[model samples]
Target chain A: AQTVTQSQPEMSVQEAETVTLSCTYDTSENNYYLFWYKQPPSRQMILVIRQEAYKQQNATENRFSVNFQKAAKSFSLKISDSQLGDTAMYFCAFMKRGGAQKLVFGQGTRLTINP
Target chain B: SQTIHQWPATLVQPVGSPLSLECTVEGTSNPNLYWYRQAAGRGLQLLFYSVGIGQISSEVPQNLSASRPQDRQFILSSKKLLLSDSGFYLCAWGVGGGEQYFGPGTRLTVT
Candidate 1:
């Protein structure tokens, strides 16, 4: 069994500042994928970024990036130049290489960007 | 472009009532489909997933059940709903080892 953990229940950041949401997972599989998803007030899950276990280099998508430490099983999401629109419930997810592509998600962190 | 849809946007039902939530995908074939539930202020819990038509796999042992009647359509159902079943139901589709695209989600309330 695999599990994802988001230690922070809630987070706040001033507009134009930077914020980092921490995430960690437990999995025995050597090959897997990590993802960050954002859900706004609309309750729609949006993909933020992704990192493959084999890739030593972290993944970056514009203002959203991930710090993936495979050995420690840590995958943290960093938001640069945060904006009001970035306020949402952020979830960290894990997916194994094969099978149905089922995702294991964290509890989620409610992020608020203050203007 | 691929798209996923779940309905009816929101639903309210009393305890012991039957449930049927529909989900469909467009612009994709043989893609993996999934059903997830999010309780109030909680993380998304994967309920079921399918790799192809008529091949369904359940992740959790719960009162809920899922079926894939068509290649692009997945349905979640329960003969009798429980108050614990109240939550936001999400449908998603994805390819092998790729990111899953989520639907708008359906808020289910069981009183």
Candidate 2:
């Protein structure tokens, strides 16, 4: 079985400041994928970004990027120039390369961006 | 483009009542569907997943069951609801091994 851990339960930052959310997973499978999802006050889950385990380069989506260390089994999300809209609950998810396409998610980190 | 829909937007059901939540996908065929539950201030817990029609895989053993009657339709049900079932229910669809796209989700309150 695979497990994802988010050590930080909550985080707060000022608008335009950068923040990083830490995530680690315990998995025996070498080939897999990692993802970051954001859930705003509307309660809608939105995909922020994803990183393929085979890719050595990290994934960057505009203001959001990830630091994926496959050897260390750690994948962290970095939000640059954070906006008030970025204030939401962030979750780190793990998925195997194939099969049922099940996503195992971490405990989630509640992030608040203040002005 | 692919889209997923889940309804009703919000539901308030009493305990011992039956549950029937529907999820449908558009613009995709033979996609994998999943059902997840989110408790208060918690992450998602996968309840069931289906790769194809009439194929359902349960990840958790609880008072819930899932069915895929059609290629683009998935349903989650329970014979009798419990207080523990009060939470947000999310429906998602994906193709291959890519990231799954989520629906608007259903807020279920078991009173």
Candidate 3:
């Protein structure tokens, strides 16, 4: 059984500033994938970024990037130059490499970007 | 080139009512389908997933059930509704190692 944990229930950042959301997971599997998803007010889950367990390099998507520490089982999402549109609920997820794989998601952090 | 649709965007029913939520995918065939439930202000809980027609895997032991009658259509059903079952239900599709796309989601309310 795998589980994801997001310690922060809510977070706020000023516009144009930077913010980092922390995430940690518990998994015994060696090969897996980590992902960050954002859900806006529309309640649509959108992919932010992804990192493979085997890869040492962190994943970056424009303003969104990750600090993945495989040994410590930590994967944190960093938002650079945050904007008002960045206000949403961010979730960290994990999936093992196998048949019919399903994602295990964190509780989520409600992000608010204040102007 | 692929899209997913789930309806009724919102559903309201009393206790013990039957449920049938439909999810259909377009521009893709034989894609893996999933059903997830989100409690209020909570994370997603994967309830069921299907690899192909007649192949369904349930992750939670709940009152909900899922079926795939067609290659691109996945359905979630319940014989009777429970108040605890009220939440936003999401439908998603994916191919191996790729990203998963989510539908707008159906807000189910059982009173």
Candidate 4:
């Protein structure tokens, strides 16, 4: 079974500053996928970014980037120029290819961007 | 463009009452549908998933059950609601190996 772990329970960043949320997972499959999702007070889960296990180049989306270390089983999310709107509960997820393709998620990190 | 819809947006039911939450997806076919629950101030726990019509896979043994009558519609039901079942229920659709798109979610309060 694959399990994602988000070590940081809560993180705070100043507006326009940068913050990184750490996540690690346990999996045996070589080819898989990792994702970061953001859930605001609105309760809508939004995709922040994703990284394929076969890709070494980190995935970047606007102000969000991920540092994916496959060997270490660590995928961390970095937020640049953070804004108040960025405050939300961030989750790390893992998905295996070719099988049931179930998505396993982390406990989550509560991010607070202070103005 | 693909969109997922879940209703009712918010529901309040008494303990031991029946529960029925409906989720539907548009702009796609034969999609993989999922049902997840998020407790207050907590992360998401996947409750059920369906690969196609009439196929349902449960992640954990709980008080809830799920069904897929149509290709794009996934339903979560419980004969008797428990207080612990009170949480925000989310519906998502995905293609294999792609990021799953989530719906606005349904807030269920079981008193």
The model with the greatest lDDT is: 2
DockQ of 2: 0.89
Q: Find the 10 residues in a row with the least total lDDT in model 1 chain B.
A: B91-100
Q: TM-score for each prediction?
A: 0.98, 0.98, 0.98, 0.97
Q: Which stretches of candidate 2 lie over 4 Å from their true place?
A: none
**Model 1 off-target regions past 4 Å?**
none
Which should have the higher DockQ, number 1 or number 3?
1
* Per-residue alpha-carbon lDDT of candidate 4 for residues B18-95, written as tens digits (9 for 90 to 100): 999999999999999999998888778889999899999999899999999999999999999999999999999998
lDDT of 3 by residue, B1-111 (tens): 888999999999999999999999999878999999999899999999999999999999999999999999999999999999999999999888756889999999999
Q: What is the C-alpha RMSD of each candidate to the true structure, in Å?
A: 0.8, 0.7, 0.8, 1.0
Residue-level lDDT of model 3, residues A18-97, one tens digit each, is 99999999999999999999999999999999999999999999999999999999999999999999999999999898
| Candidate 3 off by > 4 Å | none
DockQ of each: 0.89, 0.89, 0.80, 0.75
**Per-residue lDDT for B1-111 in model 1, tens only?**
888889999999999999999999999899899999999999999999999888999989999999999999999999999999999999999997578999999999999
Task: For candidate 3, give the docking quality class from DockQ.
Answer: high
Tell me which residue pairs clash in candidate 3. none
lDDT of candidate model 1 versus the reference: 0.94
Each candidate: fraction of true contacts kept?
A: 0.85, 0.80, 0.73, 0.63
